[model samples]
Target: MESMKNRESKTAGSLIDDPVILRLFERMPHSVQESFTEEQLMHLKVAVGSRGWGEHAVDVRGSFRGWRHRYYYVMLFGRNRRHLTPGQKRIHNLISAAMLTGFVCVGLLIGLLGLYLLKSAAGIDLFPDHSLGIWDWFNSN
Candidate 1:
């Protein structure tokens, strides 16, 4: 019990020394000091960063892709299964399916465009023989 009190007191003391943290602390009542335990204060300190409270510093080295996938999945498949009606979930699923189909169609169009460019580079006859060259059409005798 003594150690817990010591830690809490230390956290409270540190809050006074750090101006940014003091500001965050000032937003709440003096009773807030007693409300949060040492562990919670430590977490808040880390989140606020030792440099300052407004400056947010986080290490997201390799987890961004996973976070993006989870975010997209929630957006496409409705978050909180219990709260969603059956019809809502079904609509989300249909929207997801439609988006997937659109992506596939776009992929196909890009592939076709690539093939056309390749064929054009290889001197394939895309236009008829009657088609006038730009120089021929533009030149005046």
Candidate 2:
């Protein structure tokens, strides 16, 4: 009866309650986690808990809810990316530069178009102005 009662009672601050420790456990490779000792787990819990979660932590946690396993797997093993060959690297750089240039050109064109539209017709407005505009068409009032 004494042993049964002792086993049933849990001390406060269990690893199961800590989100950071749980996350670290999940992020660790299966073999690594399996070999980890209770003391090591406790140390990890304290270390992770001491590092305060930042402003973006909530946003990250929200997104991770559904994809936690996938995210953990990728984080643990996806960093070993294949090196690009010299030609492939050159082509990648060229493509990146071209994309950046295209983006800048598109932005400039849009700005110029906006300026032209604003300056061309004084009566023309992007937003609904008076009774004859889009508001009246939708509201009929």
Candidate 3:
């Protein structure tokens, strides 16, 4: 009996209710939400205006008499931002970043091209009896 009762009790400050912010927080990349107080999580349900145009009619044209379920939509107002390290900031601009990436890709391509050309031009077939064109003329003689 005591164990059952203890499970139901929760801490006062802990956020037990899942709000919109809570769901969004899980998906934010490179971000951490500062702890929010429990009171801040309390949301009031708003009532929508009656559809009957303020007249209680025998034949109801359109009106909802039952309670409408609503929840406060909490938008994660601001992104969690960080001041970039000096080195990171130095390379942060789009042009700089794109240029760096482009340079790296270009370098890789150039290296591969050079290796292909080297193998193509060198004609030193590591495997015997493999014929590489043009350069084969040099060694065949």
Candidate 4:
């Protein structure tokens, strides 16, 4: 009987060691927790499983009071680690492509503008008869 009790205690100990089960146990009132049987604890462990909420690179939480009201906020930022559906994957790809295109276009525009300014400063013009008025505006400013 003593050995059987030891075995039961060991099983319960192992279940309680699981982080998810331990968290759940911690949340339960002490009186309620003391009343739980090993079998019930095992059931809780099985039901909760071992998965955890994903970690975040940045996690911020705060509370503030304004106008006699209290408000809370959470901000989490991280690389996505979840599985994506095919349509969702396609949308992600499209967004990524569009961002890349926009970035490249902006970079090229800045490079061309810099080159044009340099050429104007050096008194070099490909078309002497026409003006974009940028150099004149730059000089006036």
Candidate 1, residues 1-141, lDDT tens digits: the string is 224356546644554455555667778876665566545765777777565323324323232356447332221222232556899889989999999999999999989767765665566766757433433333442
Which candidate, 3 or 4, has the higher lDDT? 4
> C-alpha displacement of 133 in model 3, angstroms?
11
Q: Give candidate 1 regions above 4 Å deviation.
A: 1-31, 34-84, 129-141
TM-scores, all candidates, are 0.40, 0.32, 0.23, 0.52
Extract clashing residue pairs from model 2.
none
Q: Rate the local accuracy (lDDT) of all candidates.
A: 0.59, 0.58, 0.49, 0.78
State model 1's lDDT.
Answer: 0.59
The runs of at least 3 residues in candidate 4 whose Cα sits more than 4 Å from the true structure, single-residue gaps closed, are 1-54, 60-75
Worst 10 residues of 1 by lDDT: 72-81
Shift in Å, residue 90, candidate 1 = 1.6
Of 1 and 2, the candidate ahead on lDDT is 1
lDDT by residue (3-68, candidate 3, tens digit) is 312322656444433454455445555223433333443331112122232333232333334467
lDDT of 3 at 107: 100
In Å, residue 117's CA in model 1 sits off its true spot by 0.7
Instruction: List all candidate RMSDs to the true structure.
Output: 12.5, 10.8, 22.1, 6.9
Best-fitting candidate, scored by lDDT? 4
lDDT of 2 by residue, 18-107 (tens): 676668867777556556555666787777677433323123222244544633222122232458899999998999999999999999
lDDT, residue 18, model 1: 58
